[model samples]
Target: MNASTAWRVPSPAEIPGLSYDALVEHLRLSKVNVGHYQSVVSALQEELAKRSPTNAYRCTKCGHTEYQVGAIRTARSGWSSFFGVETAQYHAIICAHCKYTEFYQGKVPPGQQALDFLFGS
Candidate 1:
């Protein structure tokens, strides 16, 4: 087979019912390099570093001030959704001894402002 035959692009006519959003979602889920996902992530990291919110929690033993950002996991045990499925619930924790800080997971609810800025929404 020739190079063109080996690397043929799929046409919408061949792929019956693929909507633009669906195709975009497929590309995103497949981790395709359609856009600068890394750049977005980097910008997010920078924003997180700059505007990390801290919760004050005193250690029961040492009594040190701890700065922490909430944490979250992308996947979980069992949850259902119309499109795909619910991933996981976000959570937060604090350091007991040294009162170290943690990375920001996503958002803190009623705080879409940060997301709007990050995504330009």
Candidate 2:
């Protein structure tokens, strides 16, 4: 995928002005709606903690708890389905030792809670 389509960590300049209102507006217009990108990171940190070695979460394939959340992404369901189109969000967690990746549903705050509720959180 091209850089435009691929996900990457945003630069500091990419963030809106440093202000509460700017932060609010950022969340309001975000593709992954949480109060801020930092909020999303915070959530991810919490979730990853559950999978940390201290929590006894181990990679099913390699028996390791060392993993990294590569990115937050969304998936779409069939548009022609009887129930209509649907989308779900997830965190891509990969085992550092074995590079085994797993997609956990509802692992992130999601762009919106309603979206997760509708998509099976």
Candidate 3:
């Protein structure tokens, strides 16, 4: 294939759909230049890093390394609930040792947010 039609490095969103063996096979079959190959490798590495479950999350309160991610919670105040306004969403990170909990604002995808608003998640 010509340079213009050559396969490009996949984005972060696309990385999850691609298996390592499939990526290797694609690289082998494609006429990817050295720069493109390097870019693909770098992108794969980044994706792997992002997917790694070995993240070290230390609790600030008790300095515990083990933690759990709680489910996404939707919060609405009395007025907001009454008015049917948008609800604030959050995820709680709980420490295993001291039961320390930290809440972080959750980022719901636009499509999921719309569906949640419609179906009440």
Candidate 4:
């Protein structure tokens, strides 16, 4: 892969599909710069942390106490949709045993959220 294609940060959807070893190999093969490689690795690590099971949550379906936290963003209203603004953020709690997911609405500062959405950071 060329630097142009390889240097882009992985999206949330893509992070789940990439293993750390595979990501490192790909970055090495593509000869990505150290800074970019570190950024990608950090993003992947954050995703991995989010998916790791924790004892804080209990699953309503199977009574499992272990769960993982994920997140989602959406355009909630007509204007937001028309402008392609992700006005709604959600916390997704997933059961480790049965994979049952529940979403709870979350609030983030509008300016920071917009910047994150625009930059994919």
Candidate 5:
């Protein structure tokens, strides 16, 4: 939490048999703050802005660019270990058009990483 110190995501293998409550407690005590709430709506808006306006969102399968916009969570990205499951620092985008989803590695936040294994959507 200091300017001089760097943040490192703890590998899941390092933490085995950790319970959900314990993980939450550790995060609380460590002052680990995930700054923003990333939702499907937000992700879609972001992707939409980056896409070409004229072309619209093209369907890869049909080659039709016209379609409705939405964000789909394809998966949780990160290295996994016996200790815990780390969530990806950034969101993976799934396209409703043409069912094309893309993961952009460029936008993951610094010092923003997951600490435990999280299953399900």
Candidate 6:
């Protein structure tokens, strides 16, 4: 993607008199939704924590815990946008013992989250 298509922080020269409100307005217009991005990251983290092989899944039916693999859709259903891009999906393992399913939507990468958390809105 080009610079404009990707996330960027404008240089001071780009907007010498930029105020907080102005900056926020620019972000909104540019489709830079920070909360949305954070939500996706949080979802992925929760999924990762549960899907770790060492994590045990308790079967609702048998009360047994086991390890298994699973998949989750990242796309938000019934959601539309002017941009045609859809969210990515990530699949992992759940518990085999209980037939439990762990689904992770909004598959934001851990590296991306680390960058965002350390550097941005």
TM-score of each: 0.25, 0.35, 0.46, 0.47, 0.28, 0.29
Model 5: per-residue lDDT, tens digit, 11-97?
Answer: 344223333333333344344434321222233333334443333545556666554433322225443434344333333444455
The top-ranked prediction according to lDDT is 4
By descending TM-score, how would the candidates be arranged? 4, 3, 2, 6, 5, 1
The 10-residue segment of model 4 with minimum total lDDT is 21-30
By the TM-score metric, which is better: model 4 or model 5? Answer: 4
User: Mind sharing the TM-score for model 3?
Assistant: 0.46
lDDT of 6 by residue, 1-121 (tens): 2456345444435443444334444445445566544434343334445544446556555666765665543333444112222345565646566566655343555565445445542
Model 1: lowest-lDDT 10 consecutive positions: 75-84
lDDT tens readout by residue for model 2, 32-65: 7444465344433444454444366579898987
Between candidates 1 and 6, the TM-score winner: 6
How much is 120 displaced in model 6, in angstroms? Answer: 28
Model 4 accuracy (lDDT, Cα): 0.67
Give me candidate 6's TM-score against the actual structure: 0.29
Q: List the residue pairs that clash in candidate 6.
A: 66-97, 67-96, 68-94, 68-96, 69-93, 74-106
Model 4 off-target regions past 4 Å? 1-56, 113-121
The C-alpha RMSD in Å for every predicted model, in order, reads 17.1, 13.4, 10.1, 11.9, 14.4, 15.6
* Clash-forming residue pairs, model 5: 12-84, 15-83, 58-65, 85-116, 85-117
Cα lDDT for residue 49, candidate 6: 51
CA deviation > 4 Å runs, candidate 3: 1-54, 75-87
lDDT against the true structure, each candidate: 0.41, 0.51, 0.62, 0.67, 0.38, 0.47
